[model samples]
Target: MRVAFVSFETVHHRESETNRRLQTILELLSEQGHDVHVCCAQFWDGERSTIKRTGISYHRASAGLEAPTSFLARVPFVLAKLGPDVVHASVRPPKQALAARWGGMLARAPTILEWYGDGGITNDWWTRRAARWADWIVVPSELVETWVRELGVDEATVEVVPNPIDVDRIDGVSPGDSVDVVYARRLDADANLESLFLALAELRTRDWRAVIVGDGPEREAYEQLAGELRIDDRVTFAGACSLEERLAIYRGAHVFAQTAEHCVFPTEMLWALAAGCVGIVEYHADSSAHELVEGWDRGFRTTSEEELVDAILEAGGLARRDTDDRFASYDAGAVRDRYLTIYRTLQDSSSLV
Candidate 1:
């Protein structure tokens, strides 16, 4: 199948869950012998119209690009020319994804609109219209599924597909040499790193070190909070990391604690779990962390700062458990197969028409 993946930006920002998902999907699709093309708003070194990574033909069009008559720009010409069997896009703020969705219509291909951020996700007029227009809405969590349903899209058209975990790349490693708790997320209010700091403060007397990965606007504040809590000596701030560093950090850590207040789908947490870190997450009703860690002994859910501290303590000493058997359904191969089947179904439907 020939497929066009329309994204805001995948090459420039690789750490983001959206980018990660796009890369994984494209690679797996290419491996499965599908002709895949990537159309992003931004590409390598800001260069436009170049193919990169896994033989994907890359194209670009500014979301804000317009004609002088004040008419909105039609779908990207490159995408329309490709005329893919299916046009998939990641919908988010900045309205560019909606533009790409329009481009899919111009390309005359069935579109699968992707949106993963769900908690506190509000739709505007254009978003609602795009939701109605797309052939299908692919959401990563039940929370996101709810957000799309709130837009009044037909229930049948909304599919809750969890983001696939590359289990092969995340196989459990032997326990590290020393005990170190790990927290990997963009440091921001939503991440609620303060909770992790507070929890760590309680464990200051314990023999453990923490490596906080990822960077954001709240990094300074989180650092300040850590100093105030006097755990700065024990915590190392490792800013925006490469895929190799992140994988190593998760695999080497004894505990991986996530303290987000409202995470739709915690990608870092999932990776940590798959890498055999005894997982602990601050519980929230809206977080997909709850959904992933539910009924699993390797993961513990905490309600408050005290519970988080206790869970961390328990997680630190936990032995590596075989999680592959438990999370097999989320294996990248399984998810790739599911997507292939979906694409085939769409193609078959179009042929029938």
Candidate 2:
């Protein structure tokens, strides 16, 4: 099958969850003999507009900030020439979703839109228009599925497929102390890092340290909060690290802590769990991330601050169990095959009718 992905950001241009996910998918699809083309923007200098990597073709969108808009404008032309069977997009960028809808129509192909947000955008004029225009909607969790349905998307057009984690890419290395806790994610209030830092402070009685990975707008505030709690010396604000470096950190840690207030299933959590940190942390009351580790016996879960502290202490002390059983369904190949199922279904002439 010929597939053209309409993305504002490419893996080479940006290092993000979407970039990583798309790279995995496109590479796998290309390896499987599918003609995969990624229409995206170039992030750095001397970057060619069209480059091929691992059998996938990447066509740079534009030279300006309005690249996504300009790229969408050319999707029809590109699709006309490439004549792909499917056009993939996302709803995060309202403009890209809207444009992909129009481009798919121009190319007479089915456009699949991944809606990762919990809020229903169906009521918003532009979002609703894009949602209506999208041929099929793919969401990661049931929570998001319900939201998209409430937004007036056709029920038959929506499907739930969790994102994939490159299990082989992660390192399952837990330190001997087992009190080495790590928080790997963007530093945002929504992440509930305030609660995490406070909980870490409470656990100061133990000989433990924390490695906070990733950088975001809340960096300064989190740093200040750590000082106020007097646990600054025990924590390391590592900022962001490369994927290999991140996996190594997760492996060396005994526990991975996450405190999200509201979030779709985070890809970071999946990678951490895969890398063998006896994951600990309660799912935010309003978050869908809880679903990721709901039944896994390899980690811990809690809701309140007290429970979080207790879980951390308990899980940190416990020996690492075989995490293979927990990540059975999330294997990179298995998840990619599930997506392949969707693509094949859409490609079937009967499904269109």
Candidate 2: residue 180 lDDT (0-100): 76
Over the stretch 95-126, how does candidate 2's per-residue lDDT look in tens digits? 78777767776777778887767443445777
Which residue pairs clash within candidate 2?
Answer: 173-251
TM-scores, one per candidate: 0.81, 0.82
Candidate 2 global TM-score: 0.82
In angstroms, give how far residue 74 of model 2 lies from its true place: 3.8
What would you estimate as the lDDT of candidate 2?
0.74
Model 1 lowest lDDT segment of ten: 63-72
lDDT of 1 by residue, 165-258 (tens): 7787765444333446888887777888888888889988887789989999999998888899988888899899876567777777777887
